[model samples]
Target: MNILVTGGAGFIGSHLCDLLLLQGHSITVVDNLLLGRKENISHLLNRDDFSFMKEDLLNLPVLKHIFENGRFDMVYHLAANSDIQKGSKDPGVDYDLTFNTTFNVLQCMKEYDVKKLFFASTSAIYGETCDRLTENYGPLRPVSNYGAGKLASEAFISAFSSAYHIQTWIARFPNVVGERFTHGVIYDFIHKLQANPEILTVLGNGEQIKPYLYVKDLVEGIQFICEKACERFNVYNLGSDSRTKVKEIAAMIIEEMGLDARIEYTGGDRGWVGDVPEFKYDLSKINELGWCAKHDSNASVRLAIQKALGK
Candidate 1:
């Protein structure tokens, strides 16, 4: 099967591309290299079965041209704005990169008669919820622009799947961490420590808890669900069974980097305005399908830290 991964040069997408290639599938990666780094997929650049196109997804004409010719069997829409905080400052950031990216991809896919699509969604769409979120969690009121944009994309994906007969898989994800990571808590923590080894400033109350999953686990879960879940439009939550705190992650990073830095608190519950300080996942849906994350939240954080530190 021929596959098209939208953000194939990013951390998670690159890993997915690697697995797809190993499984004897031809992979075509289209990443504008905004949130995605070219180095992540550099090793596969020379492969005959793997092709990388440095093009933005917003360009409908170019996207149409590519889709008309490549003849993709499936599309993993992994492209999105990585920085959630940016959306709080400028709403257009998420509108252009997050929502618009998915919108254009669907249009081209519909035009080209692409049958299957796998959308990369986030836990942020659930908003500030106290309950462990399921895929069917009601009245999704996303606080962050990133979440809102993702929700909008999901809506369109569903609409397109129903109208055009496209088989769609939407996986709401947790804090995905691993090698070649460019954004999120672990990446930010390491970069901060590198800049100033003496003092580490943590935002929020340092008690913000959320699930963290290894990128490998996330990719594997998606693969399993795709093979097993048969529906016109499938939505599932992909995450670790457990959860982790902000301060816990800071401590992990400090220990991994061997830093003797003082931890300072910014005195708030959320790291940012739209930040959901606490959220959990009920993985019963995917677990019922006989798939569970191998690494717990703590293990995932530890592994991501080690990889980030090059240890």
Candidate 2:
């Protein structure tokens, strides 16, 4: 199968590309090098079956040309604005990066008659909910601009899939952590420690709890769901069974980096204005499909820290 991964040069996308290539599928990755780092997929650049295009999804002409010429069997739309914090600050940031990017991808897909789409949605779309999020949980009230953008994109994907007869898989991800990870709590914690080993300034009150998934577990889950959940449109919550707190993650990072830092809270329950205080996902939907996350939230954080520290 010829597969097109929109953000194939990023953390999760690159890992997915590696697995796809290993399974003898030809893969082409299109990334803008914004949040995605080229080094993430650097090893696959020399492979005959793997191709990289440093192009933004917003470029419709280039995207249309690539789609028309390549004739991709499936499209894994992994491209998006990764910085949730930034989105909280400026709503327009996510609108352009996440929502517009998906619109462009869908338009190109329609033009090229591409029928299959695998989208990367987020748990943030659930908003500041206290209940465990399910696939059917709705009237999705997203708190952050990032979440709003993703929800809008999901709606577009569903509409496009229904109208064009495209098979679509939308997986709502938790905090995904592991190798090649560019942002998030783990990444932020490590960088802060590196700069000041003695003072670890944590945002919020440090009680914000959320489920997280290891990158490998996430990719594997995606592969499994995509293979088994063959329907007109499918939505699954991809995450670990358990949850973890912000302070717990800080402690983990501090221990992993061997730093005895003074933990200082910036003072607030939420990390940012749009940040959800606490949320966990119910993975029974996917678990019923004979798939489960191998690593718990704590283990995922630990492994990501180890990889980040090069240990």
Which candidate gets the maximum TM-score versus the true structure? 1
| Steric clash pairs (candidate 2) | none
What lDDT does each candidate get? 0.92, 0.91
lDDT of 1 at 279: 94
Instruction: Highest lDDT: give the candidate number.
Output: 1
For model 2, where is the 10-residue window of minimal lDDT?
268-277
- Residue-level lDDT for 200 in candidate 1: 86
lDDT of 1 by residue, 1-311 (tens): 99999999998999999888888999999999988999998899999999999999999999999999899999999999978988889999999999999999999998889999999999989999899898899899999999999999999998999999999888999999999888888888889999999888999889999999999999988888788999999999999888999999999999888888899999989899799989999999999999999999999999999988888
lDDT of 2 by residue, 1-311 (tens): 99999989888999999888877899999999998889998888998988998887888888898998889999999998889888878888899999999999999989889999999999989988898789998778998899999999999998999899999999999989999988889989999999999999999999999888899999999989899997899999999889999999999999888878999999989877788989988889999999999999999989989998898
Q: Which residue segments of model 1 deviate by more than 4 Å?
A: none
In model 1, pairs of residues that clash are: none
TM-score of 2: 0.98
Worst 10 residues of 1 by lDDT: 218-227
